[model samples]
Target chain A: MKVIVIGGDGYCGWATALHLSNQGYDVGILDNLSRRYWDSKLGVDTLTPIAPIQKRIKRWQELTGKTIDLFVGDITDYSFLSQTLRQFEPEAIVHFGEQRSAPYSMIDREHAVFTQVNNVVGTLNILYAMKEDFPEAHLVKLGTMGEYGTPNIDIEEGYITIEHNGRKDTLPYPKQPGSFYHLSKVHDSHNIHFACKIWGLRATDLNQGVVYGVLTEETGMDEMLINRLDYDGVFGTALNRFCIQAAIGHPLTVYGKGGQTRGFLDIRDTVRCIDIAIKNPAEEGKFRVFNQFTELFSIKDLAEMVQKAGQAIGLKVEIDNLDNPRVELDEHYFNAKNTKLLDLGLQPHYLSDSLLDSLLNFAEKYKGRVDKEQILPTVSWHRK
Target chain B: MKVIVIGGDGYCGWATALHLSNQGYDVGILDNLSRRYWDSKLGVDTLTPIAPIQKRIKRWQELTGKTIDLFVGDITDYSFLSQTLRQFEPEAIVHFGEQRSAPYSMIDREHAVFTQVNNVVGTLNILYAMKEDFPEAHLVKLGTMGEYGTPNIDIEEGYITIEHNGRKDTLPYPKQPGSFYHLSKVHDSHNIHFACKIWGLRATDLNQGVVYGVLTEETGMDEMLINRLDYDGVFGTALNRFCIQAAIGHPLTVYGKGGQTRGFLDIRDTVRCIDIAIKNPAEEGKFRVFNQFTELFSIKDLAEMVQKAGQAIGLKVEIDNLDNPRVELDEHYFNAKNTKLLDLGLQPHYLSDSLLDSLLNFAEKYKGRVDKEQILPTVSWHRK
Candidate 1:
């Protein structure tokens, strides 16, 4: 089956693209390379050295004897997106094209607006393109668990059955996103659901959790094919940041009380989740949702795990509690059901000390590139 | 109190601006005049001959000695919106600026993108502007009842308490919006709710129903100040279309089984509800929602009413059930709670034969201007 990965130059997108190519799917990538441009704008570079899309695709072709086609343009541009869709005509489209950073989105009004327009408009364009050209294409959209925003109840996979006043009906799980970035995902989910309802367009919204680890099997193939590792205050996940902090002898910064628990998964697991979703497409006119995470941990839990991992490596690691920059519950119940993907034969990879050590080793290799100033939160969610 | 009426040249926006201005609030209108542009693009016009913004505002000023400031620019443009907000420094911003037509939204892929981008981006710009410049401003956003697409079970006012697995929590009511236009409203509600939560911004999402009626006390002041009455396939509501059909001696065109029930209110009630939302503002960081409609009616009920009203005026009106161009439940149970607005002291103008006669009389006055060819459903929700 033919598949197109939008935003294929970004970290997860690139990893997923390579993985799908390795799986012998006819893979193609369409990206505007905006993430790289954003890194340039923020004066931050990925800790991991990553090749250009052209070189990365060429390397993958040489390494695996698989040619992944590349189309570079903004998905927000309908003409370009439709043209790309017409040319590729994939049976499935994996959408990872979005401004995917809460901190980056909350940096300022400009950043906030840019995040909304880029993410929401880009997703809407994809829906429109599918309706107009490839109505049969299944959209595997990467939503975030952040879209659920640490609700008190156990998070259902994609929807919840509500018995209101003796009448029972199931509906999309109520969203309470924490930031402009996550809010955009919620918006995308709504639009995609509506489009599916009206147009019979098949879509699966993957409510993915925080992804950690640097080396996917495809990325570990070569030095040049490595995925970008963002260890900045903006784009980096807490676990990844904690591991890097330990490697660089910086105190692991925990926001507030560090009781903000969240679902998490390895980068490899994200790839596998996407693969499972693609392989098991949503039925026609169905907007399926799967909670894509292998484990749940709080900031303190992650910090302690990193510290333990550091101790094993003969390194001293300390933890510091900082005032929370984002407005969220410091402590909350976060038990999300992830049985759908598991039921679909997903072998979970829980975070382990061995995994932490590998990530620390990778961070140690790039210790010189770790900018300490970018490690602490700079943008405050509260306006002064 | 200074109030900025975004999209103030449109139907509900114009009347609300005038009503607020009449009530002695300093009112300003910020519109891109996109609705006018859309009418031109669609080769249709409002059944009622409406004057341009300049003339309308001038007429209001001339008659009532109240000046409403006008800012002619797109709200999607952040700079323009911020500039308007800074100048106005509004205590309340009434947001009615959106592509409000479902049929127009479903016309084509381009139309769908335009509607989503115009509505969602415009609302996002307003949120960011408020966060940046007027954090204390009470945003009175005109959400639609269509956001709660005819669902089984009782639709609570903006939220529902779900008792799941022996635990109960109140969440924003599960939305099943029917159209791209309504879906954009759902997206706005999510984004606005997030903005209020994180930024301590105060907002009230008025989930207004389909507004009918051509004349408000403010709009009835002068011909130039008259609100635009859309009676076309794309922009007109079913009741208004039926009234026009009666006025022009045409069939009361119903779609399919015509059992699609929906909440509705008079244009006068819409203006009054906006006033109530502004007067009793949502608290800081609270995203309060009110289902703003006076009554509920099905398509067949509206058609029958129009037929009876036509009979009262000695005009023989025929009823015809055309194939449903939209993919929606032709028959569904719809029970929605709307007591919040009533509790806020919104004395609703319930649909009565007298009210129907008034609207029919107004339609008869512009019967010559009514484009009979534009009355039927032109845009099919089903993709061909």
Candidate 2:
């Protein structure tokens, strides 16, 4: 079956491309290398300096005898997106194209506008293309845990069946995201849901959390297949930042009292979840949603976990409680039920000591490239 | 007190401008005349062909001796919006600036894209400008009743407190709008809510219903002060369309079983709601919402009312149930609470027999201008 990944250069996108192609599906990748440009702008490169998209696809073909087509373009260009959909007629389309950083969105007015436009317009274009050309294709979109924020109750996958005032109905979970980027995702989800209702198109929205680790089967053969290891404040994930902090002797920065907790999964597991979603598409007119994370951890718990993990590798990692740059609850109740992905046979890899060691080893090789200035929070939610 | 009204040329916008200005406030209108162009494109001038913005402002100045400045530009233009915000530095901003037609949104791909971009980007520009220039400005934006399609239970103003699995939190209701234009409103509301949380910029999103009638104080002057009233499908409200159908001896086009009930108020009451919302500004960091309508009526009931009222005014009317163009629950439950505005001292003018008679009488004067082609459903939600 033909498969096209819209944002096939990011952390999870690259891995999915390689794995799907290796599994004998016709796979193609489309991206603008926006995250790379963002990293370059911030003077932060991924840890191993992986080869570009062409080289990555070429190396994957050489190693696994599987060819993955690659194209560099903005999917927000609706005509281009429509042409791609019409040409490929893929059985499934994986959408990961969006501005995915909260702090980057909070940086300035330009970044904020860019985030809103890129995230929303990109999703709209993809949906428009699907409706125009490949209406039968299952669209598996990557949503986020941030859309739910820190509500006092347990978060259901993407919906909650409520029985209020003696009437029962299943409704999508009410969202209250924390940042512009997250808010845009909320918008995309709602728009897609509306499309599904109106057009009877098939779609899968995986509300995944903070993804960590970067090992795909293709990574084992060639370094090009290894996922991006962005370790800067703007481009990096929580775990990636913590690892770099430990390596560079910078404090493992914890915001406020550090009781803010969230669900997370390995990058590999994200690919696995997408694979499962593609294999089992939702019914036409039905919006299937899965809470795609395995476990949850607070910031303090994660920082201390990294600190201990670093100590095991002969690196003393100090901790610091910085004034919280973001305006969020330091301590709150958060219990989201991510049972859907698990039920879909996601054998999740928890954030173990071994995984931390592997991450550190990757960072240690590029210790010289770790710019300490990029480790601090450059964007604040509160305007001072 | 100073107030800047975005989309100030709209029905509610103009009415609010006149109402607020009469209440002794410095009011300036910022509009791009997108609605006027939409009216032109649909080949239906507002049933009452009112004067243009400049002429209306001139007339308001001449008659009431009240000077309300006019800034003619799209709110989507961030620079223009920000400059206007800075110049006015108004304590409150009435943001009625959005593409509000459901049938127009469903017309085609081009219309959908236009509605999404115009509505969302316009709201985003307004929000960012508020954050950058005037954080203290209370933004009163126009949301819609369609945002809460046909839910099973009672709908609160802007939020509902849900007790889920032993935990309770108030959330903006799980919006499931049925149209691209309404979907845009849902997305923009999320943006406004997020902006309020991050920037502490107060905003009131008035989730109003279809506004009918044209009898505000300033509109009493002449054609210049007379508010625009569209009676065509593209820009017309259901009641306006029914009224026009009565005037032209055409069928009142009701979709499907015509059991789709919704809250509705008068143009005068819409103006009243905005003035009340401005008087009771939302606190910083609060997303104040009010369901600004008085009574509810199904589509069939509205058509019957118009037919009966028009018969009293010596006009024949027919009620025709055509194929439903939109994908919505035709016969479903709709009970929305609108006590917030009433509590804010809005004595709602419910849809009465005399008011319906008055509406029919008003339409008879413009009986020659009613175009029969503009009265039917010109858009469909079918993807095929």
Candidate 3:
């Protein structure tokens, strides 16, 4: 099987690309390298030092004897995307190529507009390209768990059967996304669903939870092939940020009441989940969705867990409750169904099982690279 | 009250601006005049001869001695839009400025991308401007009923309360829009809702149905003030197209089985709905929605009505069922609740009462301006 990873230079994309290559599938990486550019623009670096894309791919080829093809371009450019797709002709396209930071989007109106236009137009171009050229290719899109936004009802897998006023129909689940970036993902889901209905295209939307840890099997094989670990307030997730804060002896900044709950998964499980999704594709003209997460935790729970793990490793960890920068319910009912991926033969990995070895130890190793200024939230949801 | 009517140079916008001006409100017309440019690009003309924006406003001032200020700029340009808003300082902003044609959006990838980016980004700019400068201003945005495609269950206003898994919540309605144009409106609705929640800005989303006829009381005052009537395939809707075909002795083309039902209202009622919404503003931080249509009709029913009205006026009329250029259900359940606007003091004019005077007579009076080549559908939902 042939697969193309769209944002192969970023964190999850890099890990997933290597996993696919190591599994002996033909794999190609298509990225514009904007993730690195954004880091430079924001004056922040990943906690772990990472090699350039070419050097990383070369090191992977040297160690594992696997060649991962590379196509560097923007997906918003339809001609470039269509040409790349034609050149690589993959059976599955894993799209992880959007501007995926909610804080980055809420920084200002310019960032908000750029995030939405870039993400929405990029996904739309791919849909049109698939409709025109490769109708048989399966689109494995990366949506976020944030799209559901803590609704009172249990979030089903992408849709729910609503019984309204003596009638029932299974419709796309209602979305109340918090930020412009998450709203862009919601927009992409709607556009992809429409394309499937009208043009007979197949798609699998993986509404993924917050990803933690820095090392996958392929990335950990050699030091030169290490994955990027973001610790900044803008691009970093809660658990990863907490792990880094504990390592550097900085207080874990818990926003608001620290009761905000969300689903989470490890990096190893993320790569494996992508692999499982590619192996079993959706039927032609079907738009399938899966809630891809293993466990659930609130912000305070994860901070306390990190504190305990750090104390055992001879480091004093402190937890600080700060004002919330986002406009969201600090305490709400959030029961989301994630049974579809598990039914497809995915063995999950838990955070407690790998906290010391995979997360805390790695953060301790890179304590010198931590930028303290980027530890606290800088972008407020409120308008200036 | 002071109000600014965005896209006030176009068909519905033109009539709406004049109506508000005649009602003793301080009105400002902000338009980029892209509607005229698009018609010239497509090599089509409106059935009614309309003057330039300046000439029309000038004529209105001469006839009624009411000064309507003009601001000629695009809403997508943030700096220009902000400057215009600062100069006008409007208490209400009536946003009808969008690429509002479904067929135009389905022409190709370029058209689809253009439609979504133009509409979504333009609305995003407005929300941000309101948040930064005019949080007290009410946004009367024009959304489409097509955002809710024909569903098995009845369509509510903009949201529905669902009972699922022993829990209940009122969430934004699940949208299944058919065209890129309609999907853009759905994106705008989500963005506006988020803005209202976070910034305490007020907005009213009018999920309007199809609008027919050409004359409002204000637009019919003078020849130069006549509102433009589109009869081309890209911009002309079903009922309006049938009226023009009946006047020109051409076959009234009904797509497919013509059983596709939809909500509709008169052009006269459109102006009144805007007036009513402006009079009763939504509360601050509230994202209010109203289904702004009075009645429902199928395609065949509209064509038959046009035929009867035309034959009674001594004109030859015929109906032809052609293959549908768009992909949609030929027959489906389309019961939608539209009592919100009527409850707010809207006296709707039925199509049966105004078919002869408003629509058919206008088509007959301007039959010489109709372009025969522009009568058939040129865009297909299926990709080439």
Candidate 4:
């Protein structure tokens, strides 16, 4: 089957591309390579000197004897994306192309505007392209767990059947994302769902949590195939940041009271979830949603897990509670339903000592590149 | 109190501006007059030849001795909007600054993109300007009833309390707007709600239905104060189109089965709802929402009402069920909760014979200008 991966560069995107390609699918990666420019702007690089997409693809081809085509373009540009989609005619499109950094979105107006525009416009273009050109294709869009926010009640997968005033209507659970970045994801969900209903387009929104333990089985083979581990404030995920901090013997920086709990998944499970979604596409006019997470841990718990793992590997690690920068409920209720992925045969990789050790070992190799300055929170959620 | 009405040159915007200014508030209107450009582009003008904003403001001043400050600027420009907000320090802001028509959005790719960027960016600028300058101000934004595309169950106001699998949570109702324009509103609601929560800004989102009446209490005083009554295929509201067709002795063009039921209200009630929202400010850190409408009617029912009212006024009006240009459910059930605004004291003007006669009389004056071609549907919602 033909498959196109939008944003095929970030942590989960690259891994997803390689995994699908390894599985003998005609996989293609579409990315603007803007993340590298953003990393440059912030004066921070990934933990390792990440290879270019060409190099990574070449390495994957050599390792797996498979070819994954590459389309370096912006999804927000409809003409470009439309032409690309028309030519490719993929049966499935995995959309991961979006600005996914909370700190960067809060940095300045330009970043905030860019985040909103890039994420929203890109999604719009994709929906329009599919509706106009390839109506039969399945769209597997990556939504974030943050879209659900920290509600006072247990969160269902993508939707919850609401009973109000003796009447009932299932709603996409009320979303209150933490940052503008997360809010953009919420917008993506809204737009995609609307488009699906209006045009009978199929969509699967995987509301995944912050993924760590970078690299799927395919990515783990070649060093170049390994996921791009961005440890900077702008492009890094929480678990990766924690591991890098622990590996460098720097204090694990936990924001505020560190009671902010969140669901998390390994990079492997993210790919598995995507692959499952591709295999089990939603019906036309249906927007299938899955809260793509496996485990839950507070900031304190994750930091301690990293600390313990680092100590086991003979690295001195301390815990530091920094001022909470983002305006969010530090302590709130968070129980999300994630049965859809499991029902689709996803055997989740739990965060155990071995998982922590694997990430620490991986982080140790890139300890010298950790930018301590970027580790500290720079943008406050409440501009007050 | 200094109040700013953004997009105060469009149909509802100008009516709202005149309504608020007449209420003795220091009101200012900020608009780029893009709607006129769009109207000109479509080779159609409003049913009534509306005066320019400057002249309208002048006439408003002449009649009531209440001058409305006019800023011919786009709210999409953050610098311009921020500066305006800082200078005005508005206590309340009524945001009608969006491309309000659905068919216009579905016309083609260009229209779709323009609508998305114009609406979303304009909303973002309003939010940022409020955050940067008038943080204490209340924002009354206009969302559409189309945002909640017909679902299987009864619709709640803005949120629904859900009980799923022995657990319960209140979530924003799942929005599945029919057109790109409506989808943009859903996205804006999410983004604006996030802003309100994060910045502790007060905002009220009025999810209103189609507005019909052309005469506002303020507009009735002078021709210059007349809100633009668009009868063109692209920009015309359903009722206005039917009125123009009736006045010109043409068939009332209905789409599909004409059973597309929706909630609707008068232009006066729309203005009143805005007034109520402005009077009752949302709490800081609260993104309050209210269903803003008075009554519901199916397309068939509305057509019959228009036809009957036309006969009562001595005009021969026939109902024509043209091929459904729009891709929506022609037959569906719609039961929406709109008690919030009624409780807030909105005395609605029902579609009585006298009221219909008033509309017929008003349309009679502009009967010569009605192009029969512009009264029918042109844009197909089905993507090519």
Candidate 5:
């Protein structure tokens, strides 16, 4: 089987590409390297030192004797995307190429507009390219759990059977996304569903949860092939940020009541879930969805867990409460169904089991590179 | 009261702008004149001969002795839109500015990309401008009923309370839009909802049905003030196209079995609905929605009604069933809730009552202007 990771230079994409290549599938990496560009633009860097894309790929090839093809261009450019797809002609395409930070989107009007237009138009171009040339290829698009917000009802995978006024029909789940970046994902899901229905295209939308930890099996094989670990306020997840704070003497900044709950998974499981989705493709003319997460945690719970782990390793960690920068429910009912991926032969990874080895140790080693100014939230959801 | 009608040169916008101006409100029209440009690009003309927007505004002032300010600029340009809004200082902004044709959107990849980007970006710029400069202004955005692709269950207004798994919550209605154009409207709805939630902004999304007539009370005041009527396959509605075909002695083209049912109203009612929404603005931090149609009809029923009306007016009419160019259900249950506007004192004009005076007679008078070459569908939903 042939697969292309469209954001193969980024964290999850790099790990997934390396894992798939190690699994003996012909792999190709297609990225514009915008993830690095954004880091430079924002004056931030990944907590872990990582090599360039070419160097990472070269080191992997030397160690594993596998050649991963590379295509460097923007997906929003139709001619470039279509030409790249035609040149590679893969059976499956994993799309993680999007402006992914919610804070970056909410910074101002210009950033918000750029985030939406870039994400929505990029996905639209890929859909059109698939309909025109690669109708048979399967699209494994990465969506986010943020698209669901904090609805009162139990969130289904991608759809729900709504019994409205005594009539029942399964419909796309109602989305109340909280940010412009998440709203873009909701738009992409709708667009992809329409394309599948009309043009007989196949797609599997992986509505993934917050990904934590840094090392995947392939990335851990060599330091030169290490994955990027973001610890800044803009791009970092709660668990990762907390672990980093514990490693140094910085306080774990908990926004508001810290009762906001969400689903989460390790980076290793993200790669595995992508593999499982690609192995079991949706039928032609079908749009499938899976909630890709193994466990759930509230911000308060993760803070306490990180505190205990740091104390066990002889580190003093304090938790501080601050006003929430985001306009979201501090406490809400959030029981989302994530059994679809589990049913499809995905052995999960738990954050509690690997906290010290996967996160804390790495953060302690990279304490010199941690920029303390990036630890506090800088972007507020409310307009000034 | 101060009002700014965006895209006020287009069909619905022109009618609504004149109606508001005549009702003792200070009205300003901000348009890019892209509607006329698109007609030239497609090599199609409106069935009704209309004067230029400047001439139309001038004639309205002459007849009513009321001035409507004109501001020519694209809403997609943030700086241009923000400057115009600042200059106008509108208390209410009526947004009817969008690429409104489904077939035009599906012409090809370029068209699809253009439609979504134009509509979404333009609407985003408005929301941001509202947040930055005019937080107190009310936004009366023109959305389409087509945003809710015919579902099996009865469609609620913009939200439905679903009883699922012993839980209940009123959420935004699930959307299954059929085309890129409709999807763009759905995207705007989501974006607007988010803006209202986070910024304490007020917005009312009018999910309007197909608007069928060429003249409103204000537009019929003089020959120069006449509203444009589209009769080409790319821009024409079914009832308008049927009336035009009857006038020219051409066959009424009904796609497939013509069982595709939809909601519809008169062009007069469209202007009236905008007035009603503006009078009763949504509260700050609230996103209100109203189903803005009065009646429903299947395609076959509309064609048959045109046939009967044409015979009574001494014209021979024939109905022709053509293969559907767009991929949609020919027969589907389409019971939608539209009582919100009625409860708000909207006196609707029925198609049966106005078929002769409102549509057929006008089409007959303009029969010489019909372009036969533009009658049949030029775009297909399926990619070749």
Candidate 6:
């Protein structure tokens, strides 16, 4: 089967691209490399040194003897996007090309506007391109688990069956995104669902949670094929930041009461979930949604886990509480259903102590690259 | 009270600006004049000949001695929007600045893109500008009833209280918008809701229904100040088009079974609702929603009403059923609660025979300007 990955240059996208190529699918990557540009603009580099796109592709081909096609262009450009879709003629398209940092989006009006335009408009182009050129192709879009904020009710996989006034109907889970970036994802979900309803398009929206870990099966093959590890306040996941802090003997910075609970998964599982979604295509006229995370952890829980891992490695680790930069519930109910991917035969790699030790050891190697200035929260959700 | 009316050259905006000015509010208009550009691009003019914007403003000032300040610029430009907000120091901002036609949005990919970009990004800019420059201003956004597509259950104002598994929770009403234009409104609602949540900004999203009628109390003052009456396929509402068709000795063209029910109000009620919203400001950190319509009618009901009105005026009006150009439910249950606006003291203008006759007589005076080709549905929601 042929598959095209729209944002195949970033962390998850690059890892997924290698995973799919190894599985013997004809893989083509289309990316604008905006993530790299964002890094330069913010003066923050990844903890792990990621090779350039051309070199990564070359190394992947060298290791596995698989040719992964590359097309570097913006998906917001319709001519470029449509031409790529027409030339590739893929049966499945994985879209991850978006401005994905909530902090970056919240930094200023310009960044917020860029995030909205790049994410929502870029996804809209894909929907139209599918409707006009590639109707048969299955669109597997990466939505965020953040779309369903901290609602009191259990977060169902993409939808909820609400019984109101003695009548039952299933609707897309109520979206209460906490940040502008997540709001953009909410917009994409609504737009994609509408396109399916009106045009009979097939789509699978994977509302994935925060992903941790840097080394995937494909990325571990060579030094040059390494995935990015963002330990900065802007792009780092909570667990990843804690692990990095733990490695350097710095305090695990816990925001607020350390009570913000969220679902999480390993980088390996993210690639595996993409494979599962591609193999199990949504039916025509359907916009399928899947909650794509393996386990849940509170900030306190992850902090303790990192402390334990650091002590096991004979390093002293402490936990520090900081004022929460974001305006969110310090303590809230968060139970999400994530059984869809498991039902599709995804063997999730939970955050084990051994995995934490491995990640800590990896972070130790990149300790010199860690910018201490980027480790703390700089952008407050509230205006000064 | 100082108020800024964005997009104050268009149908609802112009009327609301005049209404507020007559009520002694300091009203300023900021518009990019994109509506006029759209009219030129579509090669269609308003059935009622609209004077140039300068002339309309001049006439309003000459008659009422009210100076409505005008700023011609795009709201998407953050600098221009911020400058206007700073200069006006508006206590309230009415946002009607959006691409507001469903059929125009469905014409092609370009239109779909333009509609989403203009509407969603423009709204986002407002949210950011409020946070940065005008933190205390109340934002009154004009949403559409079409944001909630006909559902199996009854629709609430902006939220629904659902009882599931012996637990009840009130969530934002599930939005299932039909067209790209309505979807843009949904995006705006979500964004504004998020902004309120995180930034403590105040907003009122008026999910307005199809506004019929042309003359408001203010628009009736002078010929140059007449509001636009669009009878074209792209921008015209069903009731307005039916009345125009009857006036021009053409059949009232109802699409398909003409059983598509929608909530509606007069142009006068729209202005009244805006006034009510401004008077009743949403609480800080609250995204208040009000259903802004007074009556419900199907296409067939509207066509029959126009037919009777035409016959009363000694004109033979026939009803013709054309194949539906849009992909929608021909017959569906639509029970929407519009009590919020009523509770806000909106004395609605019902569609009486006198009212219908008045509209038809008004349309008849400009029947020669109505292009027969513009009356028919040209853009199909279905793929070619």
Candidate 4 clash pair list: A162-B162, A325-A381, A327-A381
Writing each residue's lDDT as its tens digit, candidate 5 over A1-384 gives 999899999988999999999888899999999989989999999998999899998999999999999999999999999999999998999999999999999988888888998999999999998988899999999999998899999999999998767778899999999999999999999999999999999999999999998888899999999888888989887888899999988999999999999999989899999999999999999999999888889999989999999988889999998899999998998999999999999998787645554588899999999999998999999976
Off by over 4 Å in 4: none
lDDT (tens digit, per residue) of candidate 2 on A12-89 = 888887777777889999898898898878777776677888888887777777877777788888778787777777
Cα RMSD to the true fold for all candidates: 1.5, 1.3, 1.0, 1.8, 0.9, 1.1
lDDT assessment of candidate 3 = 0.93
lDDT of 1: 0.90
Q: Rate the local accuracy (lDDT) of all candidates.
A: 0.90, 0.85, 0.93, 0.85, 0.92, 0.91
- Per-residue CA lDDT of model 3 for A1-384, tens digit only, reads 889999999999999999999998899999999999999999989998999999999999999889999999999999999999999998999999999999999999999999999999999999998998899999999999999999999999999999988999999999999999999999999999999988999999999999998888899999889999988989988999998998999999899989999999998999999999999999988999999999889999999999888888888999999989999999999899999999999999887735654589999898999989998999999764
TM-score of 3: 0.99
Spell out the clash pairs found in candidate 3: none
Q: Candidate 1 vs candidate 5: which has greater TM-score?
A: 5
Sort candidate 3 into its docking category.
high
Clashing pairs in 2: none
Clashing pairs in 1: none
**Best of the two (1, 3) by DockQ:** 3
Model 6, residue pairs in steric clash? none
- lDDT string for model 5 (B1-384, tens) is 999999999999999999999888899999999999999999999987889888988888888899999999999999999999999999999999999999999998899889999999999999999999999999999999998899899999899998778888899999999999999999999999999999999999999999998878888878899888898999999888899999999999999999999999998899999999999999999999999888999999999899998888788999999999988999988999999989989999887745554588898888899889999888899765
Q: What is the docking quality class of candidate 2?
A: medium
Question: What's the residue-level lDDT of B2 in candidate 2?
Answer: 96
- Candidate 3: lDDT of A220? 94
Better of 1 and 4 by TM-score: 1
Tell me how many clashing residue pairs each candidate has.
0, 0, 0, 3, 0, 0
Residues B215-332 of candidate 1 have per-residue lDDT tens digits of 9998998888888888888998889889988998999889998999989899999999999999999999999999998999999999999999999999999999999999899899
Classify candidate 5 by CAPRI docking class: high
Candidate 1: tens digits of C-alpha lDDT, residues A1-384: 999999899989999999999998999999999899889988888898888999999999899899999999999888999998999989999999998999999998778778887887899889888988899999999999998987778889889988778788888898889988898899889989988988899999999999999899999999989999988888888998888889999999899999999989999999999999999999999999999999989999889999999999998999999999989899888888889999999998888878998999999999899888888888888876
DockQ of the candidate models in sequence? 0.71, 0.75, 0.88, 0.56, 0.86, 0.71
Q: Report the first chain's TM-score for all candidates.
A: 0.99, 0.98, 0.99, 0.97, 0.99, 0.99
DockQ of candidate 1 against the true complex: 0.71
